[model samples]
Structures are given as structure tokens and as C-alpha cells.
Target: MRYIAIDVGSTFLKAAQLDVQYLAITNMESIRMPEPLPNENPLVKEWNAIQLLELMQGLIDRQLASCPGCKGIWISTQMHGFIITDEYGVAVTPYISWQDERGLEYADKLGSSYFSALMERVGEEAWRRTGLWEKPGVAAVGLFHMLQQADSGMEIEWEGQGTACPVSMNDIQTLGSKRLCTLGGYLIQSLTGSHVCHFTNAAPTGLVDVRAGEWDIDIVRAVGCQALQFPRIVVGTDIVGHYHSRWGAIPVYPDIGDHQASVLGSLADATNEAIVNMGTAGWISRVSDAYHIGEWELRPYFEGSYLPTITKLPGGRNMAVLVRFIADVGQSIYGTALTEDTLWERLLAEADRAAQYFKTGKGQSSNGQLHVHVGFYGKQTVADKGAIDNIDSDNLQVGGLFAAAMEEIAAIYERNLYVLATAGEAIEQITFTGGVIMKNAFLRDAIAKAVGIEAVMAPACDEVFHGLLRLALVSEGLYASVHETREVLLQAIL
Candidate 1:
């Protein structure tokens, strides 16, 4: 059998045709990210919907025309965006991406007490923060706090400044998720005339009701969103429906936010294996039956959600800042822009330097017990004018600093993983995925040594897309369970 998968991303739309039996990509194509609205709000849009629709339709048609074996079109859209609709289900707002920082105000006012309470209740750290970081892929609670501050009569910057919020004074209702948790449903309706943002995506929203597994009045009250305006929240793998104007009417499974699907898709086995996605960003989380919230001060995750037991560090995403900092020198010294391909080359070169650093420290044993956690979020890792702070060249030269950063990152990963492993989620093995892994061999090795597990490199590393495809197939029972899906997946890969 064959399947076609589509991933609508921030910078591009990736589409591929895979032969399920062999688990091979028969054909694949990518469309450069279309121009977005360029709005300051980032979450809201300026793109002309008609133009977007036409472009997407053309892209799909072109791909289908070229790939004869295309079985179906499965899509995973940009996460953390919302497409609200009216009573008749017409889109009321443009997509609001997680990329949008509009909610920072609200995240701030979240007040430590409220945040702590929620973390205790939901059992995840991605929602809130503790120890200077939260779980990977978690939106910044600062955004929500910022929103709250603005609402309470502070300076507010929004898409429609004078425009009122969708929430109301008497708005007391239950909500399963907040923020961009519902993008998939909007895309489904636009194409298939329906709404379907599944639970996987919804779970990340601070507003999700982990207790009830559905939106609740208390959540809406807390987060202040229009929960009722959304379509019903579906299961991550539920086959929402099908379309067959001859595009091959395969099931329209509601893919969860790509990350969650990765968790379900990359488990090494039923009991112990875990995976880390080191893409544009990096996340190291293990699959577990229990939730592990960090200490009260570490205040991670909000109430009423169940996901990532703990998070490792904040420096993974900082790689980009480091690159941008090096860009001036790259253009002048290295003579290469920090594009994806070139970035990988630079990172790989840095990895060699890291290996050298490790070699120098090897045999030190006790003296080699150095640790660091690289965080790119505060600004870029390097000191630029707008950057939070430039790396201290006095102690942190390019090569040595890279080594130190990796070491710090490794230390944080070890701390979080071991803390949980000792507590209960004894992660026996681990796999690595995402864009960062494409070149940063040192990181993979460092992580492996730090954790002391035989790290597995999933043959296909695009976790979100691959995970979505597997999720749909498994959810349909086309494969028996996650285990069966893995078997078929391994075969298809072979």
C-alpha cells in the first residue's frame, strides 16, 4: 500500500509519497513557505485567503499529477494557530501561530501561585516553567502573562488594538485547549468543509482540561478564550472522513500537533525506549505512564494537562542565534549565509571541535565532570545589539564555547532524564530526530554518552510528518497497535 503525507510548516509545505509496505519515499516535493501577512502580531495574518487557497490547490494538484502512486493526502498544519468560525462554521479569524508572541502579557500575570497550582494538577512542565525552563515545544507562558498584563490596563499590542477580544465579561465556560491548539480543524474545514483539531494538539494548550479530557468552564475562565467557537476536539488518530473527487479517498485522520505524534510514533518499544527531536528546536522527552512535574519553583506546565513529565533545558533553539551572530563573519570570513544546508555544515564543523574538546577532557574523569545548558531563547546565543548578551569571548571562544554549550546542554538533558528515570520513567533506550541531528553528530553522541543508552537514529528523521502518517494508519487499525505500526514502519523503511 502507499500513502501521501503533507506537512504545512512555517517556512514550507512538505509533501511526500511513501510505499507503506517498503516504508520508502517513492516521491517527495516541497514548496517554499508562501508569504505570510507580515503582521507584527505574528499570530494574526495579512495573507489573502483566496490567494492562499489557490496556491495550495495548485501545489496539491501539481504533486498529484506527478506522483502516480499517490494514495491519499494527509496534512499536518502549522501548530498554535487558530481559525475561528461563526455559528455557520465560517472562519472568523486568520491563523494564529505559536510563533506569535501576542499572548506574552497574559503569560506573565499567570502569577507564580496560579502557575504552580496548575503544574501540580496537570503533571507536565511544558505549560509553565520551573528552574528557568519548561518542557520542550511548550509555548512561552510569558506570552500569556503579557496578555494578562495588557488586559489589566497595561500597554497592549494586538492585531486589532481597539478591536475587542473574543472573550466576554460573563464568559465562564470549559475549554479543552488555549492558543493555537486548533489549527488542524481550520484547515480541515477549509478543504473538506469540517472542523477537527484533535486532542494531541489540544493538550499543549494551557487551557486543556486534562481531568475531563475536554474543554471545561474553569479552563475558559482561566485562559479567557472562546472554547465554544471551535469544532469538536477529536482523537489524534481519528479518521475524520474522506474525500474522493479521485484524489483517492483515504481516511482523513486528525493528526495531533506533530510533536505528540512523534512521541507515539518513535517509542522504541512498549516499555523503555524514548526519543529526542533536535530539529530547528530540540526536545528530549520520554514516553511514560506517569506525569512528572518539576519542583514548585521550577513551575512547569499548567493545570489540567498530561504530557512530558519533565523538560531538559532552554538552549536547544539558541543555535539559530549563534548562527545569525556568526553570519556577519560567515559572509565576511566563511563566505556562506546561514541557510539550512550551510548551517548544517557549520554545525558539523563545530561538532568536530566539540569532539576535540571532549578528547582534551577525556581521562580527566573527576575533573571532566563539567556541565552546561545552552539556551537560545533569551536572545541569540551570541552578543548582538538586540541579542540578550554576546557570548563572553574572553572565556567562550567560538570553538571552546561551542564545546562548553554542548556540555551544558548535555548536563541539563542528563539532569532531567536521570531525575525522572530514578523516579519511575526508567528510559531504557532513546532515539534522535529533527533538523539538528542532520549535522550535529557531536550532540547526538554527547547525549548518548550522557544518558548512557544506545541512541537510535530513526532512519527517517522528520518526526512530525512521519509521526502523523503512522498515527493515522495505526488509529485506523490498518495496523493493530503502535507496536504493529512500528513493524510495518520498519519494513517500509527497509
Candidate 2:
């Protein structure tokens, strides 16, 4: 048997055909996400739900045309984004991108005192169900922003300001209210006509009860949702629906979150290994059944388990800033601009040379003081401009600066890992992924050195794609669970 695994990403919709029995990728393809409307509001980000669904249909058509034996469709989607749909599953509003921040403004409008008081009242209940705090960009906050706008007679625009559509307000306040679901839930409903979501996908929305796999209606009502709708929460292995094509009827599994799917796809053993995915955003996660509520995010994993995750934004974004700085310097000095790739190549070479110089006792090291804090969301400090301290003439070059940045990143990872260790979740092995870490071998070594752990590169494949495939297999009853299939499949591939 075979399966078509799809990853609905923010920038692209990726699809792959895999032979489940042999655990091999037969083919893969990607379609760039449909561009959003140009708007004056930088906070507004929206995508066309109808167009995305059409793209998915086209990709599925192409896959089935070539590989006629595929039996299942499993999806892993970008979480937090949401859409409002009519009863027939047609989109009534544009898909709200997770990047949208109008919800943050709405959150601020609640006033700190009132917000804190409300959190105190609903904090335990919300976290008990959702396994997440009231993050500004999640779906629940977005919904609040939408409903409050409708109530206040403000135009319902994506991310607070854009091209106004009073029609959306009418649909929203219609006598029989429409439904709201995350991007994954929207797709599942569109495809299978089922209002369903997986617990892993629902946990991030700030509306689900993580343990019960159901929406907390009281919390929903508290958010000013008079008649808000939620998809039925399902487990990872349940066959939620089926798609009938000319080839055959293929079972469809509920969608999973890209982060959780990436962890599974990274093939880390849950008992001892922690997965570190470094991309445009960075996340470090480990799986366990025990749910410890803290500053870190607690997400639903497979089989009613939980994953403790620490997310950071300083991965590729910080590296990009450094590369651009070097590129600008080269442009000014050499009278020619350097491309990002070329600058990184030069940076990696320089990093190697600097490492050798330090090894030979000819260069200075930061001694852990020169920290480059990447404050994408003000997690560290809103006013903190990242600094480089204790600099000397011997280590003032770009190579030293770049190396110091890597060390700082490594140090942050080490600190978080140490905290997890204190909490009795000691990481025995580290697996690394992300364009920055995967391309730069020295960065991986630096992380391994700083964290005091041996780091291995994640499988050089689309981890989310493979992760969803394993879930599809489990849904087909080929294995007892996602974790079991993950172990057996990873052992075979590794």
C-alpha cells in the first residue's frame, strides 16, 4: 500500500507519494502558496482558502495520476491560522495567517488589569483544555478580534486593516452563525465534509481541552463567541474521512500540527532524544506523558501524550542579519555586492579558519559574555539591542563575531536543555534540523560543544511529510500507534 502525505505550509503546499510497505518516497512536489493582497497594514496577512483547497486538489490529482495505488491521504498543516466557513463548508472569510497581529492589539485593548483578571478566572480552564497560554497570534485571539470588531461596528478586515468587506460582518452575524476552524480543520471539512480536528492541531488554538479532546464551550463563550463552532477533536490514528476518486476510495486522516509532525518525522526516540528544528523559527521539543504547565508550550503529541517545547525566533533570522551585515561590508569595501549564499560560504570558511586559530592559541574567545540575543517577539526584552561585549583587537573580525553568535545560540539551547534536565527530562541525544544548521557543519559542532551533547543531523528528508505518512499508516491499522510505527519505520530507514 502507498499514501500521499501533504504538508500545508505557510509559503508552500508540499506533497509526496510514499510506498508505506517499503518506507520510500516515490515522488515529491511543491506549489508556492497563493500570494495575499497588498495592503497598507503590515500586520494583516491573509490567504485565499478556496484557492489553497484547489491547489491541494490539483496536487492530489497529479499524484494519483502517476501512482494509482495510493490508499490514504494524510496532512500536516501550519498551525494557528483560521477561517470562517458557512454551513456548506464554503469559506466566508479569508484564511487568517498566523503572522497576523491584529489579535495582539485586541489583546491589549482588554487592558492589563482586566486581561490579567480574566486570565486568572479562565487561566486554569483554558490551559487545562488548550495546553497553551493566551498567545496573541493564535486562532482564539483572532476570533476574539473578529467578533469584537463585529460587535463594535468596525469593518472586519484581515489583521484589523485592509480592504474592507462589510459582507463578512453580515455573514458573521447571520441568524444561524457560521463555523470557525483552523486551516487544517478547514481543509478537512472542505475535503471530507466533516467538522473535525486532531488534538495536536487543536491544542495550539487556545480553545481545546487537551485531555478531553473537546472544545471548552464556556471558554468559547467567555471570548464573546455567542454561537461559535468548533470541530470535533479526533486522535492521531483515527480515519476521519475518505476521499473517493476514479482510482479508489482512500481513507483520510485528521491533520496534525507541523511542529509535532516534524518531531515525529525527525525520528527521535521519545524516551531519550530531543528534536531541535532550526528554521525561519526555532523550536526544541521532547515528548512525554506528564503535563507540566510552565512558560514553555505544552502540545498534544500522539496517543494522548504531550510534548514540552521551547520556541525561539533567533535561528535563521539572526543568521540572516549577520550574513547581510557581512554582505554590506563586502559591498562597501570591494565595490561589489555579495549574495547571501556566497557570504554564508565565505562565513563558514572564515569560521573554520577562526576555529583553527583559536585551537592554536592565537585568538580570543568570548568566555560566554558576548551574547547575540535575537529578539523577534521581545521574549528577552523589547528594548534590548543584542550586544557583543569584551571584544579585543584579535577577535574583532566578522569570523569571530559570527562564531560568537553561533556560541550564543548554542548557549541558549544549552540553558533550555538544562532547565528541562532539572525537570527530570534529561536529553540523551540531540537531533538537529534547519537550513542554517544543516548547511553549516561548524554550527552543529558548536551547538554540540556548547550543549555538551553529541548532535546528529536529522534525516535529510521532509520530516513533516514522512511524519504524516507514518500517521496515515497507523490510521490504516498497519501498526498499533504512531509512536510504534515511527520507531519501526525510523529503524528501517536509519
Assess candidate 1 and give its lDDT: 0.52
lDDT of model 1, residue 449? 90
Worst 10 residues of 1 by lDDT: 296-305
List model 1 lDDT by residue over 36-111, tens digit each.
Answer: 5556543334333334444555666666777665556666665445543444434334444555444322233454
Alpha-carbon local distance difference test for all models: 0.52, 0.72
Name the regions of candidate 1 deviating beyond 4 angstroms. 34-36, 39-59, 66-71, 87-90, 106-181, 244-251, 290-316, 332-347, 354-373, 379-396, 422-425, 475-477, 491-494
Q: Candidate 2: deviation at residue 373, Å?
A: 2.6
Deviation of model 1 at 37, angstroms: 4.0
User: RMSDs, each prediction?
Assistant: 7.0, 3.5
Estimate, for each residue in 18-79, the C-alpha lDDT of model 2 and write its tens digit.
68778777679988888875567666677766777778878877888887777778878888
Candidate 1 residue 103 C-alpha distance from true site, Å = 2.8
